[model samples]
Target chain A: AQTVTQSQPEMSVQEAETVTLSCTYDTSENNYYLFWYKQPPSRQMILVIRQEAYKQQNATENRFSVNFQKAAKSFSLKISDSQLGDTAMYFCAFMKRGGAQKLVFGQGTRLTINP
Target chain B: SQTIHQWPATLVQPVGSPLSLECTVEGTSNPNLYWYRQAAGRGLQLLFYSVGIGQISSEVPQNLSASRPQDRQFILSSKKLLLSDSGFYLCAWGVGGGEQYFGPGTRLTVT
Candidate 1:
């Protein structure tokens, strides 16, 4: 079985400041994928970004990027120039390369961006 | 483009009542569907997943069951609801091994 851990339960930052959310997973499978999802006050889950385990380069989506260390089994999300809209609950998810396409998610980190 | 829909937007059901939540996908065929539950201030817990029609895989053993009657339709049900079932229910669809796209989700309150 695979497990994802988010050590930080909550985080707060000022608008335009950068923040990083830490995530680690315990998995025996070498080939897999990692993802970051954001859930705003509307309660809608939105995909922020994803990183393929085979890719050595990290994934960057505009203001959001990830630091994926496959050897260390750690994948962290970095939000640059954070906006008030970025204030939401962030979750780190793990998925195997194939099969049922099940996503195992971490405990989630509640992030608040203040002005 | 692919889209997923889940309804009703919000539901308030009493305990011992039956549950029937529907999820449908558009613009995709033979996609994998999943059902997840989110408790208060918690992450998602996968309840069931289906790769194809009439194929359902349960990840958790609880008072819930899932069915895929059609290629683009998935349903989650329970014979009798419990207080523990009060939470947000999310429906998602994906193709291959890519990231799954989520629906608007259903807020279920078991009173």
Candidate 2:
């Protein structure tokens, strides 16, 4: 059984500033994938970024990037130059490499970007 | 080139009512389908997933059930509704190692 944990229930950042959301997971599997998803007010889950367990390099998507520490089982999402549109609920997820794989998601952090 | 649709965007029913939520995918065939439930202000809980027609895997032991009658259509059903079952239900599709796309989601309310 795998589980994801997001310690922060809510977070706020000023516009144009930077913010980092922390995430940690518990998994015994060696090969897996980590992902960050954002859900806006529309309640649509959108992919932010992804990192493979085997890869040492962190994943970056424009303003969104990750600090993945495989040994410590930590994967944190960093938002650079945050904007008002960045206000949403961010979730960290994990999936093992196998048949019919399903994602295990964190509780989520409600992000608010204040102007 | 692929899209997913789930309806009724919102559903309201009393206790013990039957449920049938439909999810259909377009521009893709034989894609893996999933059903997830989100409690209020909570994370997603994967309830069921299907690899192909007649192949369904349930992750939670709940009152909900899922079926795939067609290659691109996945359905979630319940014989009777429970108040605890009220939440936003999401439908998603994916191919191996790729990203998963989510539908707008159906807000189910059982009173």
Docking class of 1: high
lDDT of 1 by residue, A25-85 (tens): 9999988999999999999999999999999999999999999999899999999999999
Of candidate 1 chain A, the 10-residue stretch with the lowest lDDT total is: A95-104
lDDT of 2 by residue, A1-115 (tens): 9999999999998999999999999999999999999999999999999999999999999999999999999999999999999999999999898778788999999999999
Candidate 2, clashing residue pairs?
A: none
Candidate 1 Cα deviation (angstroms), residue A66: 0.6
Give the whole-model CA lDDT for all candidates, comma-separated: 0.96, 0.95
Off by over 4 Å in 2: none
Where model 1 places Cα greater than 4 Å from the true spot, the runs are none
